[model samples]
Target: MGQVIYKERKNTNSTKWDDCLEKFGKEDLLPLWVADMDFEAPACVKEALQKYLDQGVFGYYKHSDGYEQAFMNWEASHHQYQVEKDWIRFAPGVVPAINWLLHILTNEGDPVLIMPPVYYPFKDALVNNHRTIVECPLIRRDTGYVMDYEGFEKSIVEQGVKLFVLCSPHNPVGRVWKEEELRKVMDICKKHQVYVISDEIHQDLEMSGYHHIPTATVGDYDEILVTLTAATKTFNLAACQNSIVIIPDAKLRERYDEYLTRIRISGGNSFGYIAVQSAYEEGAEWLKELLGIIEGNYRYLRETLEKELPKVWISNLEGTYLMWIDLGAYVRPEDMEKVVRDDCGLAVDYGAWFGSGENETFIRVNLATRRENIELAAERLIKAIK
Candidate 1:
């Protein structure tokens, strides 16, 4: 059963692979960089897409009851998050919604806080909207990552930052936010009247023993918290291009509607509705099995790299199919970055990709592919680094 299948991604024009050749003058590299999985999307999503194609009508669309039902069913069954239908609204992608939320809430030059070596997109979204970003970087203990709440609170108070973007099951770092941790951050934000934007797209990718608690789960009094999630990462549905902005309070949703309407970003495409519904409804079993595969890959990679490349440390992953490898002990951070890209012919997401000086000597590798693929890439990396 561990016979990792090899599916040829060549000539399919995969952005993670083919685009590197086209964009960076290289195509032969093993791509373990982007977040999307190499596995095929669940069958039901394909079937749904096919049905719409069979119908042969592509037109402007509005989200409807079926769409709402899909989200409701999925959230209840898989996450147990129990989101109401009316509470969810559509956006093209989570990044877009991040920018939009910043726009609706903050003014120019106002400070927005984030914990870095977090998501690169968080920094990008803030910069694009002309807001100043205050990075209260997380502190990594011997066992795991913990929030720098003292630093975060200081930033909030000193900068008069009106907003903070929280990345749970944090990208690159892969620590799922514990409930107590979430409570602390939320309480601080509550005290400061700071708006929190929780990017929870990886909620569904939690590993065993870890649960993703929506920032909204703690209390109903706060109108400032908005949780952003999508079927994209979990169901391999990014190409479908839709996300849900969950606003528990009605007035917050009203502000969202106003902002979305002016730009005509109110709903989604016909197939976005179909793909999300199909994924949430029919893709649970597939997801469970996929998570098992991902966890196994994480273990295998960690053991292999630790035993063979002892100097390189593969952090114990608590969530997501991503691995953050501490390569600094092996080589200079910059040289490690170049060696992975050049000598190994492996284009890993360099430490610099997450943010300057944030993930220095730390590179992220997306392991959401067949175990054989991951193993071969690891071997190549070992050979190159050696």
Candidate 2:
């Protein structure tokens, strides 16, 4: 019981669990939709954050040399991508960084491309920033979701797409883009001079065997790619609101750098910088353990569905703890979001809102929670499905 208490999120205003009723318009639903996990951050991270908090002097701060080195070391050691300290630029979060990219790079009505059934925000970010969205939805095949390079190539030209916002280890539908896939996309982007802004925030949460391939590594087209990532997702540090836009090309970096400065919004939050440095420096083993827990939860859900609710379909998840459940078998035209909330008491992302067809009835569940909660949610869902 005490072990479970360690991960206490109650009263923390935890967006994933604590405040879901306000978000989904219901009070008693089990929240499993958002990507954040329910486990306690590593002891090392808590200690580091507390050390700063105890100082009691909260003021504006900048990225120290150690903070920059943490980025360099983690990228090289974990993902095998070598990045110089100068390349990493701070942002409040990756989504905000995406919005900023739209404003800085594209003029009004310039098209920004995204592959859907994605994170959903990709579309919102474009529309809110006054950029048109060009969709190149991933091709679902036996091997999993693919780039649909042929459709993608044609769209890049047809839409006159200036920027391609890509999700590596794609969300909702979890397929980590292989190096070969990246090579092809990068080549196409280079051919058309389309700037590639990759949201690699989930880069660190990959399941055991699959490794994340950095877009900046695939080709010599240095200036064209700006990779966005952070410790926010990895360590549950979103409250710190820290994200890094890794800009390898100095000239391109300078353009964004100048824009961020003019707005006075680029410095990022003080706690974010502090947390990221500490998480990378001492939290690797804890992350490894956390991955094991997440993988187990995934396996449990799969087995439960197979044995108890064989009709439901689950996407073959490769990276991230987010699970996409295909509910096309059970969806009605009007009661899509209602069925899950009322019948099952499970809160999940409606697939229709993610630019998928109405027939593609699906939902997303996050598995970064305790094993007990996972079982309870699955049991409740199995009853609902029946």
Candidate 3:
């Protein structure tokens, strides 16, 4: 595989670049806010898409047996999780699948639990659908964030929490959860009979020296667990809108299928199917190179920020391309926007957006861009802070 160069995405209808002004209110800011990468999709994915386009038929499509096989093979080979073909189901995106799960699994006003400093959508899925959100914030340690196993179980029992959304290889603060940690969580949720939706969307983007363990692989909690994953985040095919939901329990699968039927979400797009199949089947080498670039970017940002802006502390990035930084010492929560946006001219995901509350001086930066972009952003931040 050859080296993949970063492409210019400013005028390419990219939400991360093209819509920065509309989203962040800054037209000239360097965007490191969105989760999507600036890198192009793998050559195999592009080739498959082009082949489909050349056919010139935009009619309805169906997933072939090869699609399911590709997904199953990828899970087994990459993550060491043996997923059966029958367990696989389709959805346009992980967030949408989450929303659907919210509707089907829990009742209105029932408490749904999430760990904060978590992916914001977990909260939104509950609030938007009128479900009560039970927050069990992860304990922040000097090493990194860890699951509050005691607090987590207590909340589920005390709040009568029916569902839990687990962000494996957690977002913002990147912590690829250990097997012991996941086992404890499974044990707790099992004792409480709480259903878990493990969102492993960032599973494939693990940094060096860390192995991402699938939640279901921890133990036999199939009756109470569902894993949501996608290639879009891994392969930069978010626009293709493809994700996989794996349910091992027959009863749970039936319930979810019934709900999809009720909502009339029977099938996914043709391109999504093709892209997912192509990515899983032929994009491994490209993924390896991408992970190395992301790890390099993370190291660059960490070194640059620590040396120049000593007050700012960057969390250890174990997984995902999002780097969580604490700028509390140098900037106040109330003035973070002005400093980062106006002074630094850098658009980043403010900590508060990820449910950090008033202690909003943390920022999540995207490290999935070119090295030059990373260097430029660091220089601007260091200069601004000084």
Give the clash total for candidate 3: 0
Model 2 lDDT tens row, 1-386? 23211376766788876776787888667778888878776677778879988999887666688988987899999989999877878888899899888877789899888988888889998888788889988876653678889988899999899999999879978788899999998999999999988999999888877989888888787868889999888887778888888888889988998898888875866677878899899878888888888899999998897788777778787898898887666666467666788887877777776776742577888888888878988887777667
Best by TM-score: 3
How well does candidate 2 match the true structure, expressed as C-alpha RMSD?
1.9
Q: After superposing candidate 1, which stretches have Cα over 4 Å from the reference?
A: 1-6, 22-24
| Model 3 per-residue lDDT tens digits across residues 1-386 | 45565889988888988887898887978999889988889888889999999999997787788888998999999999999987898889999999999987899999999999998988989999999989999888876888888898888888999999999989989999999999999999898899999999999999999999999998999999999999999999999899999999999999999999998998789999999999999999899999999999889889889898887877789999999999998988998999999998898999999886633999999999999989988998888888
| Model 1: how far residue 103 lies from native, Å | 0.4
Highest lDDT: give the candidate number. 3
Q: Distance (Å) between predicted and true CA of 102, model 3?
A: 0.7
Off by over 4 Å in 2: 1-6, 358-360
Estimate TM-scores for all models: 0.95, 0.95, 0.98
* Model 1 residue pairs with clashes: 21-26
lDDT of each: 0.83, 0.83, 0.91
